[model samples]
Target chain A: MKGFLLTIISALLVILVLNVGYYKEWFQAKPLQYWTDFLKEKDDTLSIEGVMASRYGVAYTMSMRIKQVLEQKHVTNPVILFEPNSYLRDSLHLYPKIRVPEPAVFYYYTGLEGVWINSPDTGKASFLVRISSKGVGLDVIKTPEQRHQLLAFYKKYPPIL
Target chain B: MPFLLFIFLFICYLVAGYGLLTIFKMQLKTAYMITLSLLLGIAVASFVPFLLQLFYIDLNPASIFGSLVLVALVLNIPTWRRIIKEGFPAVRRSFALKPFRILSYEVPYLLIFGFFTFVSIWRCYYLPPTSRDALSGPEAIAEFAVREHTMINSFFNIDLWTTNNQFKSPYLISLQMICKIAGFPFGQVWLSVVFVSFTVFLYHALKERLHPIIAGLLLLLFLMTPEMYAYTFMILYDYSNMIFFFLSLYFLFGYFKSGIRSHFYFAGLLMGIATYIRSETLALAVLFLPAILLSQRRNKDSLAKIVKANAFFFLPSFLGYYLTAQLWIKYYLPIHYDIGGLVNGHLSDWQPLFQRYSDIVTHLMASEFGIHLWGYILYFTAFLFVAEGIFVRRYSRDARNWLYAIFVLYLGVGALGFLLPMMNLNETTKRALFKLLPLAVLYLANNELLIRLSQRISRWEGTPSYLFAREPRPAPTPIAPTPAPAKGKTAPTVAKAAPASASRPSPKKRKK
Candidate 1:
């Protein structure tokens, strides 16, 4: 009985020492960060309107959807800037020149290229989006009037199946 | 908790495996006692260093010398008779004759060998071909070989220590050759094969020399060592060096028993190969060469014969790498050499040596407590065995003195080389010591355990009656028989000794 108690006491003391030592960083566990869970929770309904290079491969699909949304809002003859022979077709062919009209609103999506919204006073409707076989997501930028115009246009067109 | 449980399970399995091997070898009791003693020994040995530290003493010269003296005292104790009387029956029962049936003997070896082989294959097959270290030095050489489509010139240009341009010793290159032959995808597989083969060879070597129980226990202890096991799976030169070191010992023992010149040659060759793998093992060859030369000095053989023997021993190692280097230089770069600057830099830093040594000893003692402690515990146990062996040698004269002498010489040289006043002890020194440790522990434990058993047996059996047979026998008397015997009664009579004394041998030949 005495031996058993001694064994128990010794075991506990060892545990305490280990805990203290570890807590004091005599031994350390490596640092780890997980980002996959955050990416999975983002909203999917937003759409972008921008000129995307077809040569950009999968990055063009989002640009096309944004172009279609602008066209439905009667914003025709918007200057398209995309790389030539690029897989992303909406990109302009000219090199080193991206023309933006006055009062243009810049929309930037730090998360996904396609799922962003922006509005500005510029006459040019400039959008940047990424397209992939995964599907079309959106990023949009517009003034309050432009947004109202886009909502009314969307209500009329309703999203074709 | 799960990790702790896993470690516990692993230890239990090792103990159980050792026990099973002993029972199979018909040495159940020896196995049990050895396992218990070794585990206890490891704990005791690890603590001794710490205890010494309490006195503010340097562990180097003092602890080693003191441990040796302490071992000597422990060996001379007169407790053998009591131990033998109590322990022998249990030993005999444990090693019952049933396990040695011709078919049964092969089963355990085959099973163990096969299991380790599978494990090696699994580990190797899964190795990522391009690790960060691999991309730089040894792997860079391998990569260069693949890209150039030839192994010829890779050796000269590649260096291991500086910017992946270091010249790795030929050992890892040989393994790489195996990987190359198997195709790049199976590169890791060859390391596994090497690990499994080395381990199996070590197991057999120990088993042949000592009791099977001891061999199994040694194997278990080795496998349980986290650092050693981890290296076995990784593409490292240490594993190969460790293999060759054991192989050298195995062949040396074979040479001793058979008086085979070829065995000595093989032993020297293996030692040389081992030295190439790790420069520190080169110290071992210093002891070996002298022992061989001394043993042959009294022989009447011609000088040419001795030269031939030495050549046979040394040529394989010298020529094998020389030829490889020649080819490599001819095809790849002009010349290959180690830039000694990095090593010299280490030598210049003196403060870490004492600190690291202290830290290593402390970690080793605390390792007995749990998961993080495994490697330290194994190392400490080895130190204990060395201590015990040193103690036993005081009484056992016929014990392998030459081997012990070599061990001491190697340890001294290694310590001086690694811990020179100019050279700070670093991770490199620690790693080198770790590699040397397993074999040292095996030798120490085997020697101490055997000595104790022999002493105990001697005490219990009165040193065997045959040892005291030279004394003369008492003279016999003649008796007269009665004229008639009663019905169903037998007469008692004494017979006189014959006068012929020619049948008995002289006392000189029979003297102990």
Candidate 2:
């Protein structure tokens, strides 16, 4: 009887905690539906690139979602590179001679129109994003060369996502 | 499909581990043996492909699965027989949830274990593999292994061979490779399995020696340890080697306590695996050799008997090293160190070596991740053991000496840490010291001094130090017959014997 009661209590406790964890998004292996919805509002025309973001968390997840969305939308030859701390790496084919600017808080993402979005805080998303030195919404790429540059640069670096 | 594969592979590992335990006749408690079996399962699974690749066998998923099936069938014949004979009592016992008998007073310890278990699972699942050495070593090699289903290194883009020492041990990379073969992305579950195994085995080992409440308390201290908790999730060979080290000691202790041949065999197998896990564990041979010799108490003067018994102890480790690590180090290592040169020529730099030792000692005493008060108690008791072993000399050897032997072996490794070049002495030394923590805890919990101290403290507090004031045995078994003391020599009073059993014949008598 004692063992039975303890088992019941333990089961209840585990179920309660698991429910709380799932509600709070504390569990990993986020569903494909979650990822799809996460990138559903992303700008289709704008190519995205990032530096020094987490490999498994935001950057990797977001990049994979972008790729998934591009394929779903039937976009041709889309580039979505999100290599963390690549600016510090020397083995990349692209940016061999170019100066790779180091980010302040270890994340740097920018669209084709130079609209840079980065988190000032580590391990958390930052809503106050900047385009160069000014704030901007998710904007469209103005020129074909800019889109081509994003694709070409990512083609050279080729993130592992 | 991948998730199902993960579950299937996990079940296969458990079955294989259980089968191996039965084949070896290791009489661990049901829960304890389950953990041990799982560990053995993975080791055997990884080693199958590793051994086959050496024999030029194709190592794709189909071939590896076939190998696993063949091996399982052969081992399970004995296991199935044991089940039929024992009527599946142990299996039923493993699942039979019992009330925590000491739950009233030991709520804190239970809570701590609960929190640590939850954290271990949470860390493994939620925290992705992100360690730098992880990417460069096992993950990189595993990627290559997955792409090309052979151990042959043609597909590897990364220069793991020419540059890194991380790829030297086959256990970690082979584990990742096996995970890929099992159709999972990587074996993230491996670390958690090992972590829990170490904890369960430690509990069983201590519960065998001390009271259950005391064992729980000491395990709480272990879980509270910073480096241990941190590395519980990280993909490093340090914890893997620590598990092998703990199991080696466990079997060696059993060998000495029970004077059993099978225990010696198991110890040797574990030690060999330890050496394969980390080359540094080769130092453990120093501790094991003496124990193997001494544990064969009746053959103390018989050279031939001693040699034969020690052979059983040495053979498995020899196979463990030659099969995996020695093969990798010989052919794969880009820049092998001149070990003889390092030992002989490097002794001149005494000042720097001493400095590194000092740094390691200091790191062990640091507040964060340090076992707090228990750490100091362990060190103080360890010093007393050193003095007793050296000065008294008449102290008859016991299972506690097994702990002392390991303590001394760790000291040698700690000092050797200073001489190695280009290594981060602080971080490397700190991690190395974590291995020493469990050994020290076991020693303290079982030592005569600590037992007396607990008694004294209990008297002062007007309460028992341990909830149960009886000698704790993990399983209900007969007390092993005490060996007759050698003529003109007194027996070691400190020796802790296992439950009742007829004493095996002395090695000399066996030879006759």
Candidate 3:
């Protein structure tokens, strides 16, 4: 038990050193620097939502924001057809690179149906997201012509991984 | 997080795992015993959700928790009986802590390991899974499984053509399902249990052969590997698959040393768990046969016995693939994932095999993976191989066998890439290659020069015993299928699969 306690003390010393390393940025990519930050963030860092915001940033917020817009329009069963990842990432020139989550992941976030451009069920899509210099905008496709036009425009770009 | 219930669940793991260990009559140091208890317990418990689903049991909190209590109760009968006969005092004496003598050299390493584990557990626990692999597959399925109280949920109603991840295995889904029902919404902290236990096991395994300082440094190198460290938090099949595959080999190594049938079967069981985690591991499990045959032949076993031994060693993993793929995926799920489509149709050319093998050598071993992902661990292992080749005159049996296992993993992963179209270079093959590091580290532990240096260090420190060198045990009875306990007697043979309990014998004799 004495040896175990000494071992703990030594470990504590090591932890102390790591905290110092992180504080000083002694090593630029110092190991467990986030751990020190996580420690000080104990109270503020309680929810997965905050972590998601920090990690996914615009991509996460943009999807959720779209979800809110759909809900406000009473679109209970939304079939979202998203712009191709290539267009969103490259052509749109979104800062920090918007990594468009796949349809599966999009569905995971919003609990709504999502289909990429080449998806077999893209014809079932009821909504289209168009990105421009103004901002990300969602449009309700009232007819097959509108949906097909959006699909034709999006397919001209590329597909999401 | 329902902290109390989580604590209760862990206690259940300890009790159930301790029971299983007693059935094997396995003994170990504190770290190894506790670690294996959690791992073995979690492995056994992973099956419960599957069985419940088979019987059409609800995957709700009450039913899930109830099943855990039942399984824990059932698995613990042997240990309970042992306790009933011996009384608490004797039991306490048996499990008595060794006099506290923490080596000064071991402290910093312990701290560093503790720090890494903390970061890992938090990221795993406090956040929703960020990996597309999990989100698109296991995490998505598990989230709905909790809501609907069934594995067949609305997530299956969506587009799944792009992936066969849902068809892979129920291992993660089952564990995550249980964790979510238990209280954790993310259902991934069980990974933390595995990470902590395996790290402790690996450290001890290394420390037995190398000095504490050297073992600590090697472990630091291992844990610091960026991708593997990221996996310590991320929920993925490969991480668990790597741990079990390594343990299966570690046990197989023990079988080679002790000629114990139980260790062979136990290794088979672990390999089965690995296969349960990833169906493709069945193919890799088949790769272990040559090593087993070589080891048994050197043990001078008869051909028939050797065949039977190999069968015992492989049957669980075969059954693992069979139950998960052939039965469950074939019949149970609502969706049909084209599993056969994953096989390569271009088998005749034999071109891709060499191509993939070379690509694995160049892309995985030399470039981005070696630098950014693995740090210097692989390089260090390669350097050790070169140094040993140049300087060391002879290899120990353990070193030789570990190198064989490394050879098996390297080729097996490359072969898997060629055979399975789903195994992309950047993902499946890259992760499958994680299996080599543990084997390589174990090889480093057994390296003759390191052992000699470790012994020298022990001598310099005035320790009574050399670290790696062991006093041979009085030969135990060989290879009985000792499934049942012998009327309060110990299991047939002690495999010494673990270290440090052998540091003293009588107390353990009474304990066992």
Looking at model 2 chain A, report the run of 10 residues with the lowest lDDT sum: A104-113
Model 1 complex DockQ against the native? 0.02
Per-model C-alpha RMSD: 24.6, 11.2, 5.4
Query: Cα deviation of B502 in candidate 1 (Å)?
Result: 29
Interface RMSD of each: 20.0, 13.5, 5.5
- Lowest lDDT sum, 10 consecutive residues, model 3 chain B, at B471-480
DockQ of each: 0.02, 0.05, 0.34
**TM (chain A) per model:** 0.20, 0.23, 0.74
Candidate 2 DockQ vs. native: 0.05
Q: TM-score rank, highest first?
A: 3, 2, 1
Give the best candidate by TM-score.
3
Prediction 1 TM-score vs. true: 0.45
Off by over 4 Å in 1: A1-161, B1-120, B129-133, B152-165, B184-186, B298-308, B320-426, B448-512
At residue B41, give the lDDT of candidate 2.
Answer: 80
Off by over 4 Å in 3: A1-27, A45-48, B88-94, B300-304, B470-512
C-alpha-based local distance difference test score of model 3: 0.75
C-alpha lDDT score of every prediction, in listed order: 0.40, 0.53, 0.75
